[model samples]
Target: MMRGVMNRKVPKEILDLFEKYMDNKVRHLNRKDAIHMLRAEFGLDEEQASTMFDTFDKDKNGQMSIWEFQQFYVCMGTQPSNPHSSAQEVVQKFKDIDADGSGKIDVNEAKEGLKTLKTATGRDLDPKEIEFFIETTADDDGQIDLGAFTNLLYRLKLYNAPPPPKDVKLKNPKKD
Candidate 1:
């Protein structure tokens, strides 16, 4: 059993799609930088990005080599240009978060799922903190449904940081 980092293979088609999307949306960036940029821009923490990257980087080389990236590039590139337009995408995301594909995200699932999100957004959420969140937010059913997941994402977007330009400067103005 491969424990630490799962060796899930990202299909070549998907890899190719990811690369194509990157080329069009982030022409100046290398794959690693692009990944980081996308995560930061989207307000995802390092852990989330790492989990996503790990899924695509079957070989676990730390970087998405051209070959590996190409596989994802193809899949993501062909996806509907309006990522939010597809209900299926939301459903799939919900399913992924469920982990067991159980159609319900329990406390553990929610904790783990939020941890992944924190990672993607470069945020640090301690396990105890996550447990607290789950206790407060989860319903009596002990499950977070797809609707809840969407709401959570929407809330998360509210906290997204503004992007900084390449050359950011701060200057003090003369007091009048």
Candidate 2:
């Protein structure tokens, strides 16, 4: 995913229509409706739709307005800032990984945690990559807190980085 600009535009009329769809004067879509809209109208799968919601809902509110979604383009681009942006999931993962409840994970725990993640997500992360990440990011004491762990998967490109800008070429959109 490109950590860059999003220049695509959504018309004001569509925003208005969305507001009307919700039968609320305020320009908003609650979590369920927002996710549904992304899945139905944009044809995003459930995971993609939820990720978009997590990326777009900057305030971490259960609702979003079109403008809010647009503003987040500056932060998230078309791809999310973090794949596991859901608070509950992150917390659960932290608890599962932090074996001693020390609020930190040592290198060994991190390795085990990555294995657990691979089992859960079906994404096989390279062991060498984990070593590299630990070598670089772990504290002098050789431990990382929740914040660092949250960034790990994303900073690692979830083990698959986006193509370089020069190699990227936009394909024409298909018409229905």
Best by lDDT: 2
Write the residue-wise lDDT of candidate 1 on 1-176 in tens digits: 32112224545433433445465433233547746743643333464444445545656666565455443333232243443233345456667888887766898889778776653355755555455456645667777755456545544534344333436532223212
What TM-score quantifies how close candidate 2 is to the native fold?
Answer: 0.42
For all candidates in order, the CA lDDT equals 0.52, 0.57
TM-score of each: 0.38, 0.42
**Best prediction by TM-score:** 2
Error of 2 at 14 (Å): 19
Could you tell me the C-alpha RMSD of candidate 1 in Å?
17.9
Clashing pairs in 2: none
TM-score of model 1 relative to the true fold? 0.38
